[model samples]
Target: MRGLVWDGSELALVDDLLHRPPGPGEVVVEIATAGLCHSDLNPIDGKITQEVPVVLGHEAVGRIVERGPGVRLPIGTRVVLSVFRPCGACEHCRAGRRTACRRTAEPAATPFSRDGLPVQQFVRTGAFAERTVVSQSQAIPIPEELPDAEAAMLGCATVTAFGAVEERARVRRGETVLVVGAGGIGLNVVLAARAAGAGRIIVCDRNPRKHDIAVACGATDFFVTPEASDVAKACLDTVPDGADAAFECVGRADLLNATIASLGWGGRAVIVGLPSADTELSLRIRSLFHDKALLGCRMGSVDPRTALPELARRALAGEFSLTPLVTRVAPPSEAGDLIADLRRGELERGFFDLRGV
Candidate 1:
């Protein structure tokens, strides 16, 4: 197996490796494609803290080559890898909110080994290599028609955007929606809000280059913001009363504040971005008392098994263009350079293709 590994301070590729078979209630997937996301780089670059010697990857799609007991998926099934493992018996899972499961972390599970030492699996999917192991419930079957490259995105970006607008916010028709940041995740938000029937969808970003992409993804309007106050005013002007809902996808405290302020009374704000650890945002308590709600979304708050299929259906129906968001594809060895580029804001919409290994 060849995959990228991150030590506490450095990252490297380990080409000589072996992954153990799936244990009971687990499935072994031969990864065909994986999307390199900023989240993976955050930990490696020390922007986010985590354990070291970890295999870094979460958004992926692969073929199930082996299945253990209690796993219903057959060998050779195409599946999207979900990193979040929900305890089926937990209160949150029982209430149909698997993403909010009380016991979300099920670490100490090994999917990679080198020289007989187990390596940590980042986000639990560990799809940066040829094969990986995941709990049976974490593997969502994808239709055979979708390409593996596109299906890989369902694990995070697409599903997060779909679930946030549809399930978390329950965005209705005729609602005015504002999505902050026009990155890969933000573009998905734009598309999802459009599909949800938002009458006015406005996407805000500091990059002028993303304005075109944002509009193509169904943003009715785009705002380039260096001044949060001006952006808020512009968004309100576009909707007059203010946006019915705002989604913060940049994970910056300042942008979060703007998203909160841009929402109309009774409007809901969903924060889908993964912010830095221990970060905080100040708020005006009195303003929020007017029924303005701030909501935190984790991977869109929907079951991937259900949402991924629906996204695929929409894509097949020509409702969204995966190609527009795919700006770059590189081999696994370029992880270091990719991380550096992402940190420097050089990447727009992109993903790395790992099959080159």
Candidate 2:
């Protein structure tokens, strides 16, 4: 089988990789499409920790090729795989926390091999390969009508963006919302806020190319970060008392601090982006005095079982367009350059079209 493997040195295609069959309570998935995300570049760039020589895809949709003992799902079921590997029985999962499931963390043992040497599974679910074996719990069955490329994004971008706005920020109808960054995740935040009937949707980004979709996705106002006094006046003149909720999707401290300041007295600022492990964020000490709050949202603060279905239903209803957000659909062999473009903020979302392989 072929897969995108990273050896802690560089990321590229590995031609001679192998996939083990599913064990009990597991399923082997034939991945049809996988979305490339900024987070995927973190390990290769040493921004995040990942075991070397591991298969690195985490957001994808596939068909169930086989199932292990006690697995009830029939073969050929189309599914969206969740990046969060919740064990269902762990304390966190038991409490319905999607952050981490104790036993879901990749163990020292992995089912992959490259030229006879053991390789790790990047996030316990390595969907970069032609096929991946994962616990049955990770697969969420969706209507077969959903497109593969778009379904692949539901596992990451949509969940992170929509979920963060709807859940973390708890945005209410008639309220004002501000989103920083207009990339994949950022755009989704705009869409979700619109769906919630936000009165004003403010988006800030340095890229004007995103303005079209930012508006299409429900951005009522857009700004070019560097020049426009638009962002500064947004909290001062636009909403008067500031936006009801602000989402920081850029993962930078400076912007996050600014988002915090751009909130109203009782506004909530949700951290939807992942920053460095050691990055520190600060704001005026008095910002929190007026009932203002800053929150950390992990995996959009959603339960995959429920959130994925809701997102899928909304997509099927034509609430939003997915393919329009995609910039490219290419074979997995081009993973290197495409993924680097994502790291450099050059692409919104690109998918590895692996169905033909």
Candidate 3:
């Protein structure tokens, strides 16, 4: 199999990558499409550390090609692969907080190998390759009506956006919402907020080119700015009394602080971006005194098994459109360039078609 491998120093396309057969409770998915996310860039750029060499991609949609014992999902069923693989025995999982499953932090068994040596999967689903194996629970089935590229996004961006707005922030009808970073996740946040019946949806991004899509995604107002302070100022300028809920989709400490500062009394700020492991945040003690909350969201606090199907249903019902959020689709050979385009804020969302890889 061919895969884009990150060998600690750089990403390279390798043709000899191999994956082991699925173990009990797992399934092998022949990846159709994989969404390139900012999270995939973290380890490559040193924003976060991971054991490498590894295949880097998690947001994927594919069809079950093989199944290990105990897996009930039939072969050829289309599904969205998720990074969140919760061990049902854990305390958090037992309490229905599957997103906080402690075992998720433990090292996952490397399924892919290069030259007979172990290669890790980014999270548990390395969908950048032609095929990848994952726990049965990590594969969430979707309707046939959902296109492969769009369904792939439900694995991460869309699920996270819906979770942030409906679960974490509990956004009420007619509330004012502010979102930072108009990339894949940010635009989805606009969609989620709009679906939550928000009165004002304000979005800020460094690229002016994203303004049109941001508005099309349901942003009532859009601001083109790069600085965190400037983004906050722009958000406040649009909603004078401060936003009722704020979501920072760009994982930067300064931006999170600005998000916190741009909230009204009793407002909630949800952190959706993944920051560097060593990054530290500075906060104004007084800013959080007005019942303001700074909430951390892990994978949008979503349980993929349940959340994905509902999102697919909503997509089928014309509740939200995923096509507009996608900026471009290319083959696995263009992974590096697409990632660079993403880092430069040049794409809203990019997908890798892995059908024949």
Task: Give the candidate number with the greatest TM-score.
Answer: 3
> What are the clashing pairs of model 1?
none
TM-score of each: 0.94, 0.94, 0.97
- List model 3 lDDT by residue over 1-357, tens digit each: 899899998888889999999999999999999999998988888877688899999999999999999999999999999887889787888777888887865667988998889999998888899999999888989999988889999999999999999999999999999999888999999999999999999998888999899999999898887788897799788887898999999889999998998999999999998788888998879999999999999888977778899999999899999999888999988987898899888888899999886
lDDT of 1 by residue, 1-357 (tens): 888888787788789768888898899888878887778878765776677788888898888899888888889988899878888897778887788886666675677878888787887887788788899888888888877667887788989988899988899999999999887788889988988889999988888878888888898899888766766877987887888889989888888888888889899999988888888888888768778899988889887767788888888777876767766677878877777766665665455676648
Computed on alpha carbons, the lDDT of every model, listed in order, comes to 0.82, 0.83, 0.90
Q: Answer with 1 or 3, whichever has the higher TM-score.
A: 3
**In order, what is each prediction's RMSD in angstroms?**
1.8, 2.0, 1.2
Q: How displaced is residue 236 in candidate 3, in Å?
A: 2.1
Model 3 scores worst on lDDT over the 10 consecutive residues at 99-108
Best by lDDT: 3
Model 3, global lDDT = 0.90
Q: CA lDDT of 233 in candidate 2?
A: 63
Q: How much is 45 displaced in model 3, in angstroms?
A: 0.5
